[model samples]
Target: MKIEIWSDVMCPFCYIGKNNFEKALEKLPFKDEVEVEWKSFQLDPTLHPDETKTTFEYFKEKKGVPETQARQMIGQVSQMGKNSGIEFNFENAIITNTFSAHKLLHLAKKYNIADKMEEALFIAHFIDGKNVGNIDTLIALAESLGIDKNGAQQALTSEEFNDDVQKDFSEAKNHGISGVPFFILNGKYSVSGAQPVEFFTGALQQTYDETVSPLKSLSGNENSCDADGCSI
Candidate 1:
């Protein structure tokens, strides 16, 4: 089975859902056969690096909410992250553009370390509060992940893999995917949001069954959630 996941590096649910999906795969009979491909998606394409404010401030400003409310929402998401063994320290997370971060993931794909790249970026942004949009920070991350830092810098500085990133966005639009953390199973079944582990397990079982049973498809498309405060 092939699983394609569309996610942004900064999306908390993307990280959580990925964890849940992996756990589900572990329970499946064909887990070893599963190929997961992480596709790039930017929640905030127009957002620039803002050093004066944290992500909490940016959240409050973007949604026109009180600072307290933003904290509460972050708290809820943090608690959810904890359920999946993620320690979310969003209190001081630096808000920055993630287009470069996504590009780095694309570059990591060549080195067969895209999954590690995703985890590293999420940990840096959510726990360490590192600025993923900074070219220097991204290069450092690439170096740590065993990818060529100089090559990563070249790609980030130029238009390398940019079209590949844009193509993912266009495909998401064409598929009516207005969300992050969206999972496509065998390029047919779609699961949205950070659903329960059983939901993913059931999806895996059902997809696997269809391949063995030779059944016809009847159900239509599924709905999903968009990124908070950003258009998908």
Candidate 2:
């Protein structure tokens, strides 16, 4: 079975959904048969690398919400993240463009370390509060994950993966995906957002069964992020 996930590094729910999906996949007998691909999607493409702000400020401005509401929304996500063993430090998170980070992900895919690159990027943005948009930061992240430093740097500098990233965007549009952390299983079934482990386990079982049997239904909720904002 093949699983293609469309997500952005900056989306909190993407990290949460990844963890949930991983936990569910681990319990399956056919885990080894599953090929997971991480596709890039940017929730805030208009952001600039040079522009820096804390997540609180970014949320306030982007949603035109008051400070209390912004903090409350972030608190909800932070609490939800804890359920998946993630420690989200929204206070220190730096808001910036993720185009370069997505480019690095394509480079990581070449080396079969795209999963590690995705996790490292999530940790850098949500936990360590690193500027993922910076070239040095992305190069260092790629190197830390065993990708060749010069190769990663050259890819980013030369925009080698720009088309790959754009292709992901186009695919998302075709699929009517306006949110991060969208999962496509075997190119048939999909589950949106950071659903519980049980939901993923059930979906996986149904999808897997459908491979040998007939098609079945998959159910889940959508707690995803898009251009407007994240759903609470």
- Which prediction has the highest TM-score against the true structure? 2
Best by lDDT: 2
Q: In candidate 2, which residue ranges exceed 4 Å CA deviation?
A: 212-232
lDDT of 1 by residue, 1-232 (tens): 7889999988899999989988989988788888899998888787865443577678777768788888888889989999988888888688778888989999999998998999899988988988898889999999998878779899888999899899999989988888889998997799999987889999988987876446766763345345544333
> After best superposition, candidate 1 residue 115: deviation in angstroms?
0.9
Give the alpha carbon lDDT tens digit for every residue of 168-211 in model 2: 99999999999989999998899999999999999998889888
Model 1 alpha-carbon drift over 4 Å, by segment: 49-52, 212-232
Tell me the deviation in Å of residue 161 in model 1: 1.1
Measured on C-alpha atoms, candidate 2 has an lDDT of: 0.92
TM-score, each model? 0.88, 0.90
> RMSD in angstroms, all models?
12.2, 12.8
Sequence-dependent TM-score of model 2:
0.90
